[model samples]
Target: MNSVTKARYDGLADWYDDRFVTGAEPHQPGLLELLGEGSGPCLDIGCGTGRNFETIRASGREVVGLDYSSDQLRLARTRTDGPLMVGDAAALPFPDESFDTVMVMWVSTDVDDFGAVVREAARVLRPGGVFVEYGVHPCFNGPHVVYNEDGGRTAHPTYRQSGWHEPAPWWGEDGIRRQIGMSHVPLADYLNAFLTAGLTVQRFIEPEGPPVPHSLAVRATKPA
Candidate 1:
């Protein structure tokens, strides 16, 4: 993750879910349903607040949640008493092929080298295991978007510029996303990360929206 993003999440970990994403898991249900019936361990990357624990647990796998933010894990423990690790997403502290599944939730926008994280995720999952990602639509949301104007509008900006974007008055909303900062990854660059990691993407979809997609879910599998 980016240094600025790491600090931002570290600071907002405590009340992040409550303030911004108060409802159930913000992403589509298909993400969890894709977790499969694997009896082996499953790893959840950037598992902020552990909100997805219930869905992962119901899949009947030994679930572990990993996050870079101590503040987030502190709050996560209250929600699910599961094994949680405090570490970077780019370089996960786990053995190669240690988990049967790896899932990253809404963390792609924050990581500096998302491809590194994807490779790490593929490294940890056993061959033939699955890796799931539930995130806001990369092409539609984040820095290039102006939510206050026209009830959420997208502006003209080069999509390939992926990195930390500071808050500006024109962006709208003094929300924590601005405080914590964001990294905008274009749609193609986002998919390329998975391909470079040797994870074959099987399913990808974005929920309905006019100007842009609100969120997206992707399912990939490590080669057997």
Candidate 2:
């Protein structure tokens, strides 16, 4: 991730809730429900503003939140009563099998080293521990870009591989903004990454929750 993008989010920390976290549009609740309750330490990767900390901790599990943005960490501290670390998802500062469960919710694609992050998540998880994540639907959700005036209605690319090469488009209620995101990885990449990392596939769901044509939820377990 670029320092400028990190800084931009850092600057938006105070108002991130309004800009993005007001509701469950990202489906954190459904992911949590799928994870159920586990009696072990939990590591939340890219835990911006600790939005999911309370729910994860409510299951009587010790929670540790990590994010790369300092400004976002500040907001997380205010919202959560758990340990917080200003750290990178690709380079987690913990020992092997340090956590009982690792959760990466809706933030993997945003990361540059998506594979490394997944590997690190598996490394920190204990034997038989679960690793869960939710990400944008690469199939139906295309990169949408909205330019000022001339850049009128934008369309999400129908295909993932080809579309990723093109610049992503975005149009918020506020105005037109250009977004640069990662390549649209296929479902196989997500599955193979965990399997290659030594985590056994437990569940894979492509939720059809209306308005969201495609959203993925994956749960894998490290073999004992």
Candidate-wise lDDT, in order: 0.78, 0.68
Candidate 1's TM-score: 0.90
Clash count for candidate 1 is 0
lDDT of 2 by residue, 100-141 (tens): 889886664556556778898999999988888777654544
TM-score of each: 0.90, 0.80
Candidate 1 Cα misplacement greater than 4 A, ranges: 25-28, 148-152, 208-211
Q: TM-score: which candidate is best? A: 1
What's the CA error at residue 64 for candidate 2, in Å?
A: 0.5
Q: Alpha-carbon error at 67 in model 2, in Å?
A: 0.4
How far is each candidate from the true structure, as Cα RMSD in Å?
A: 2.2, 4.5
Model 2 lDDT, residue 49, Cα: 81
